[model samples]
Target: MSIDIALYDGHPAGGRRTGARMLRLSSPGAALDDALARHTDPARHRLGRIDPYGDTLFDERDAGAVFEEATALLARCTTEEQRAAVRELRDLLADCAATPGSRLVFLGD
Candidate 1:
């Protein structure tokens, strides 16, 4: 199983600076373990600590839930642009599920 990981920048309201790297793993159990190891490894110098908040990995089941949630969110969008952005997010989530190993990242502001 091949895992694809990506880093993204994001900021939450009234939150400190932060960053995250998303990890998509084909083999859920094994890939999750590997991702944790890589995150904790000092040599890599990637992340400081794994933040539980806003951090999640979706397997088949979780992916389904996310799809539903994303759809609902998209439905609430008032503008076409907002809807499109939500649609893109939905597609990314779907791609992560489809790929054997895939990941995504949302960095802090």
Candidate 2:
């Protein structure tokens, strides 16, 4: 699987904005849990927003590591069920990024 992170700008409210930095995991379902875990580490600054569309910045190195971990995790899944779950999670991520008012900043891995 492949994964990436993106910052999005949804609104302009003075200097405060609303958006989400998404960790996009494009691998199998089994890897979803690991991917989510890897991308949400507060210490590593890998966290993202909860809003439908919001703006946030992330470190490129950290994002790349998270994706690499996710892809490796997906590759180790032993069942189709796990792979399917990863696919579902990927779809959800894509949907959030594709929201009508969202602006995505894709970070290449």
Candidate 3:
């Protein structure tokens, strides 16, 4: 199954249903999942706490921390595919961090 990390124009939880999708990154296999599973500590790694079986949402306020954790995770990736996926995630988080009113959502299986 694939997992998609999508960026939206505004906070989806606040009844902003019409927000346009700004970007979307998809993980085709277990690459992203396996990398995230390696870091279980929530205090140190926010990205690691994402539930692969459910949905996780992060607003512009959380983009910085999530980007940091994604960057850290990228450094630990051993495979090119894994690195690629995390890199894309990191980039998306970076963009989300810079854009106010934006929201990033991790859509899982």
TM-score of 1: 0.44
How well is each residue in 1-109 modelled by candidate 2, as lDDT tens digits?
A: 2333343433322234533444343333224444444444445423333122333433333334344443544565556665565455444434544454443342223
Clashing pairs in 3: none
Better of 1 and 3 by lDDT: 3
Task: Give the poorly placed runs of model 2, Cα more than 4 Å off.
Answer: 1-31, 34-61, 87-109
Q: Candidate 1, which ten residues in sequence have the lowest lDDT sum?
A: 5-14
Q: Candidate 1 — which residues are off by over 4 angstroms?
A: 1-61
How far residue 105's Cα lies from its native spot in candidate 2, in Å, is: 15
Best by TM-score: 3
Candidate 1 accuracy as lDDT: 0.42
Model 2 / residue 11 / CA error / Å: 11
| Sort by TM-score, top down from the best | 3, 1, 2
C-alpha positional error of residue 92 in candidate 1 after TM-score superposition, expressed in Å: 0.3
Alpha-carbon RMSD, each predicted model: 16.4, 9.7, 2.2
- TM-scores, all candidates, are 0.44, 0.32, 0.83
By the TM-score metric, which is better: model 2 or model 3? 3
Displacement of residue 86 (Cα, Å) in model 1 is 0.2
